[model samples]
Target chain A: MAIEKVEYWRWTESNWKNPDIPDWHGSLITAGVDIGSTSTQAVILADGVPYAYSNMRTGSNSPDSAISAINWAMKDTGLTLEDITYTIGTGYGRVNVPFSNKTVTEITCHAKGANYIYGPTVRTILDMGGQDCKAIHCDEKGTVTSFMMNDKCAAGTGRGMEVIANLLAVSVEDIGELSFKVDEEPAPVSSTCVIFAKSEATKLMRSGWTKEKVLAAYCHAMALRVVRLLERNGMELDFAITGGIAKNVGVTRRIENIMGIKALTPTMDTQIAGALGAALIAKELVEKKRAKEG
Target chain B: MIANYGYEDGSGHYYIKIDTSKCAECTAKGCISACPEKLFATELDDFDDEVVLIKEDARNTLQTNCARCKANGEKEPCRQACESDAISFSW
Candidate 1:
């Protein structure tokens, strides 16, 4: 009997709505949609306050992904499209959010979002998105001073880890905890390229290395790769990590260990940073418009 | 705003940062035609000012796409053609 294939790399999609905020009737409802390479997020804000959000895998097309993401965010929230006063689209497909009132770069959005999530003290932000990694320096107001991103290859990004997760047949959510099971830290993978690293990992596994040891090695390599980006961009104190990879203890712990700096623990879901920043921008635009009209 | 187009990776950084403020005053905009791959273009930026920028499709592939220019041992055509001194590169 043949067993069905299990796609362990796929993470569960999540949608959340704050129960405390009863209704958005009197508030200005603003929305933000981030269409990233591997995932999409929709965030809704009521009068510049956090509200509902959804995180889902991006489909082949972005417009559909944007719409579905928002729909999922509004599910059971008693919210409707008509309730939103404005929407800002951001990320890899910022231009393709069919209903966005405006578009902003992911770099700008992520910095602003981190400022809000981690508070005004946050100065450095490391965002490990699906296909890219960003190291950003921001001011107290969340304005970007300088930023660098690694998008040419998948070496240290979420996509790279996804490849490893599939190779190990381990659930993406469990990759972090499982990686720490090893008794001693293994040396990092020497190959800098994702494809080459995958092959190197396979070789190690074949040579009697356990899956956990390979994972530890890969995570160490990822941390080093991302640290190089931070060093290039200049890291400041009160550093924070965002995006999906921020949830992975394997990578985050390794990075903290190497840098000797503790990243801010997030109070909210880290994946929503871009969308939240977009929503924040939407609120600013609406305020500007209202002030101009008055 | 300075528009940085390109990415960094394990291999190294490859970027072309262009100052949009300077581009607004430029008339020739030679970077458009200077690149052998025609990687540069112009568009109304977020501030509604027409400025030069790298093509969206070429942003992520700058490493391989710009290899020939860097390997040729000549100043990059895009930066060399900029009369406004607005363009710079990270190799």
Candidate 2:
């Protein structure tokens, strides 16, 4: 089913329900946690509106990382962990979340978060994370219809950027910012594998290619691969790109040029879409319980 | 202490030896799932219908550089995930 086109607020501090608005849950709150390969994130929602968020470097164990993230977020709001009505977990490590009352797939969580932020009209999501890259297709109600995921490769994920960051002696955050300064796009990278791509980038640098050009090419190649993934999944307009890569403006701009659609990225660009979706699910579960008790 | 040996060929010779045996215990076949190149494949032999090793060349695949799959040479995920303890890392 095609989603209805509509304009959405990237961030508005909860239009759904807020403390100033009637029917706001002043005390009722829910939480969501996402445990990814490199980082873990948590989000707290009050009456279906985001109130607090936290992200941190993940520990060796996924469960430990998830728990710590939640704890950190709760502390930010000065709320005890037990004050959370329901907790939901989503990501590759969702099943390992001991505090979670339910576990959902990252696919569903991403779709839900994208829909909530960008409206249900979003048909595609290009999510480039630490260890996985995915292009997902969703229906009107934010249900995932189909998806293409690359979990075993680092070519199109943030890990690729990290490798390049190391080669350039710069932080990963600087790669995209530096890419924006390029005067001319460099030669396209030949290999999609991380090792080969790094070698190709090194060779380009040795060939007198400017760092700007090389970095731009890296962003270009990533966008190219994501575009191909979208095409493979059957591209539909009104697309939104989330995950860690969305924070990279250089890559996001190139992807927009290739796909020919403005990709929506929320202000909380690094705020873990999967965690937001889990919190939304948890909110729904809490509301159902309240209704049942009434 | 267990001896930790590595190969320059990037073929994951150690992972393969451990995974083949661990899969006999776990239902998800993690070694198969975790291997990017899928170097370790399971198939029936040509001469007989019995299963045999179907080695795949992973040189060109993405698994060549995944150093974290084995992760610091401690208890391997494929080995720890194994319920039967059929797999072992040996020099």
Candidate 3:
């Protein structure tokens, strides 16, 4: 594959604030918070369109990360936290989101977020995060029907990338870009654990493999694991890739080739998908509350 | 019985002793994989030297007491991850 440089426009809050108006749909302002293992992200939806998004490093205190990201987004959009009509939380620490009216599972949130971006046609979704890998299946309504997650193993998750990153002295961000430039995808290195994976990569380097090949091999290995998960759940049409992995063009291409479907990645806010789903759920809950009051 | 060394005052007491000689050249690094807490870290030094050391949190957890290491019996995951089989309980 020729390495084509696709310039991704920066998602600044200022640009989102003045988004083009929808043809006829009225907009509703809602918020979603996702508390990931290593990071937290918040997204605000205005009439089904994402108008604000922010990401930050997550600390042991999940609520703090959630609140901080929300504050940052609100600050950027000049909206107060109280201005949000509803808020939903998802992820490992969803229960810790203090202001959230309710918490939804990450699986459900990811499915909804992907469906919102790609329409109701998506079948399989690969959400690879720092501490876990999730392959989810959903119906046209964006409700999860089946899902598989590898939370117990660090080898198939973002931790594996971090370990390799440290070994190669390359930032995790650079690994994806370098992988796109490899001439030939090297032989797959076998190691399901972070420590073993590093050891295997080290040996490959000693054996005269170029860094690009090694990175390509790593990306393939990671993608293969996700592919297996998707296959186990039965691959369906209109597959989409989400989570942090969706950001890596190299890995996404490899996955797309294996699955034979062009994986759709959201242009607005991929990382905030979970949070946006949560907020959407929150909006539903709030409307129910208003109905009872009326 | 697990061998634990610590001070009751809870103010200052720690254990920092690993016989590198006895811990040298063992191939069964089960501890590296078995530790759920991930308190143990190992890296290859130069050519083939496996430098096994405790992580910061593991250091703190085992600080005032090295019960797991001092006891020469029972199955420890840390000992399992060690492929070299160099790490063992030292009394």
Model number with the top TM-score? 1
Whole-model Cα lDDT of every candidate shown, in order: 0.89, 0.67, 0.67
TM-score ranking, high to low: 1, 2, 3
Score residue A237 of candidate 3 by CA lDDT. Answer: 81
Q: Candidate 2, which CAPRI tier?
A: incorrect
For candidate 3 chain A, the 10 contiguous residues with the lowest summed lDDT are: A6-15
Candidate 1 chain A TM-score vs. reference chain A? 0.98
Higher DockQ: candidate 1 or 2? 1
lDDT of 2 by residue, B1-91 (tens): 0111112112322323332223333455454444443444454321122221225344223233345655566775545644655444422
Tens digits of per-residue lDDT for model 1, A1-294? 999999988998999988988766656999999999999999999888888999999999999999999999998779888888999999999999998999988888998899999999999999999989988888998877667777778889899999999998889899899899999999999536899899999999999999999999998899999998788777799999999999999999989999999999899999999999999989988998999999
**Docking quality tier of model 1:** acceptable
lDDT of 2 by residue, A37-123 (tens): 766788888777777777776678888888778877766465777788899888878878998998876777888888887787888
The sequence of per-residue lDDT tens digits that candidate 3 reaches over residues A74-129 is 76566777777778888888888898876776777888888887789887777888
State residue A258's C-alpha deviation in candidate 1, in Å. 1.6
Residue A245 lDDT in candidate 3: 61
True contacts kept of 1: 0.31
The best candidate in terms of lDDT: 1
DockQ, in order, for the candidates?
Answer: 0.39, 0.03, 0.02
Which scores better on DockQ, 2 or 3?
Answer: 2
